[model samples]
Target: METTDLSTLPVPLHPGLPMLGNTLAFLRNPLGTLHTLQRQHERLVHLRIGGRHQYLVLRPEDVKHVIQENHRNYGRSPAFEILKIFLGNGLLTSDGDFWRRQRRLAQPAFHRQRLAALTTTMIAETANWIVELKQQRSKQPVNMSQAFMDVTMRIVCKTLFGSDTTGKLDGLSAALDDLNYLANKKMLSPLRFPYSWPTPDNVRSKRARTQVDTFIYGVIEQRRQRDEDKDDLLGMLLSAEDEDTGEKMSDQQLRDECVTIFSAGHETTAVSMAWTIYLLSQHPDVLMRLQAESRTVLGDAVTPSPDLFRSLTYTLQVVQESLRLYPPAWIMSRRAHNPDSIGPYTIPAGDTALISPYLLHRDPTNWPNPDRFDPDRFVPGGPKDQLHSYAYLPFGGGPRLCIGNQFALMEMQILLAMLVRSFELKATPNQRIIPKPLITLRPNQSIWIGLS
Candidate 1:
């Protein structure tokens, strides 16, 4: 690697409105703004948002540098600091030794073998969802977004806590809705007041947080009182001990991890599945291919088994391409801990680096005809195989990559196989669906699909 003199190179800055700079434009359409920046400015572009200088990394090499090569020089940016309010010191928010410890303890639960055991749970839940859809018996438009959310939430709860949270799902959903809204608002606002201040939004946020905490703590307390050791993520967490200190996670630690899993685990997968279904509804050719593959691989089987899922290669490819277009974790930020070199420019310490997978996945340089809904891009000898390593990061890259990537992938594959095999989904005519870049890349409105 070559070092560049910080003073010698000129960083191109995106011009924006006076005073506010790109703040309003960014808040209005973050993904669009990012794509424009990548297209117009190329590799690395500088911007001033709310008087703060930030760098948008557009090239794969720079992204690799920021996230993998010199990751030690970067830490979770201020965006995640706001997330810490809801996530606490969980793996998503915590850094350094604490994060490492938590990751180690929680890692076993997401292992391939462990996740395989949960496949039956995932398939059973999807089967039940299929039954409910069939009972509708009409071409009634259903909100696939919410439908996916409901099913994924149940799957996560059962797999993680080893209990059915069907009754309490509404409370958890409402609390998460409030928290995500507040978190997004804070992230976009240039001047955010302290969370301690009892403003209306803050009060609502606090109440929502309390609701989430109460439910999580209640579960933890009940499990602690039980004498049996069950086989679930929560069970593993409660029984896990630090090899160095022989200590288990405290209640607060357990709460933070559980909340993180609930928020991060369920919502992202649900959104991915919803977007995939919507995309398939719009593209009949792709849907036909997916269904054909599903039927051939999962013939006469009530549900997808581990071996059956492996054989559904085309179905898996469709899921991959869907993720390419609508990655759940769209934008991630990292703050430079010390002055570091990213390509030609030397990023100053404390400057924020924004990496947008949503933009990168659509970059014409990486994916030709970037916006086209094509699953062949992920097939063998496909366009994806020709791209840079970090070009398509739905679950991100590096050691900090999403631990549950396998779990989420398997869950989505199962759902896609089961649902597509069971139902004929048609997009509601004249309906407009927009992608809203919140904490997750969610549909701005309900995705209305008429099921046969």
Candidate 2:
């Protein structure tokens, strides 16, 4: 039951243009706008966005309040309905007992030991990308964003579905383009025909959805009938049975989980890797340290193994710093199920409160010289060790911390080590590139890179 009480909304609403509120400014510069408003008022600032109530919570303690300490009173905001367009009722979008059960069933596949075994698969796919990049054999700039997206999508497909999506990449790419466009547009504009209506946008989304469904469902059906090796995440999901009732996931549930894993596992990792490499291009000193560490750890080896991953501390730090500066999962919105108090502020029930990793990670109070790209902040007992736990959650926090967090970090480490050790990468000179904040933070323009 959502509380409609307005008494708890004590903060003054941030000013915006008439009728539209701050939506236009937000559309132009989301990060700066929110941070500026919060600074002008209290740490918790209210704003009317798309005709809805949203309180921007900037305090680390307030973040701890919303996502950790008093989490039960909060739930996935209505904003998640957009994600469900692709993810369905999987762990990313589901709530309560359903999400709990899905998490339990899907948890075993992501165990450290199980994921360690997939390191080989991750390296192989990355090596394949290297081959593809080399075959192009040109020093001219290529779109590194799309390149990372392709390689990461291939890696996730192989590890999660037990096969590489090389052949289906073109089709999958086109389908995702359509879906992403619709989802982004709807999120920004907020007025569109019901998905069921025969609007042109709805039809395009449906067609794309069907194309992806065919591929995922076909893979699931084929695997179900075949008696060959079942050693991947999909296999685990299929075989997993609830301890309470011994019930296995239905085909529908499997499809939903597979899509969830694919979307979550693929695009976010792609964006992280792209940003990591691009940031390295700009910071040669940091890149030099990373290259030194990569060469030392990966001497005479074309690919890194799980054993060497621990020794590449600087490489890991570079990745960590990249996430802090340009976190792919930058902001998340949660709705209150009941009236709640966040630090000194009150959150009325049913109102949306946004806890942004981007905001918290950039707060000077939480991080000294917050905007600077300083990997040492993450160093052991070096600044990060002193901040509150919720102050730096690139993968979120609390019970809903991303299950694939380790998986993504390990994947990025292997690829970064391989790339730096093997090739010299230069960001295309003289082009403006920025982070475009969407469901994930992505390069606003095509980030071009050259390889020697």
Best by lDDT: 1
What TM-score quantifies how close candidate 2 is to the native fold? Answer: 0.95
Q: Model 2 — which ten-residue stretch has the worst lDDT?
A: 3-12
lDDT of 2 by residue, 117-234 (tens): 8888988888878878888858588778888888888888889887766899789867876777788777776576677899888888899999989998999888988944677888
Count of clashing residue pairs in every prediction: 0, 0
lDDT (Cα, 0-100) at 252 in candidate 1: 98
Off by over 4 Å in 2: 1-9, 227-229
Clashing pairs in 2: none
What TM-score would each prediction reach against the true structure?
0.96, 0.95
Q: How accurate locally, in lDDT, is each candidate?
A: 0.86, 0.83
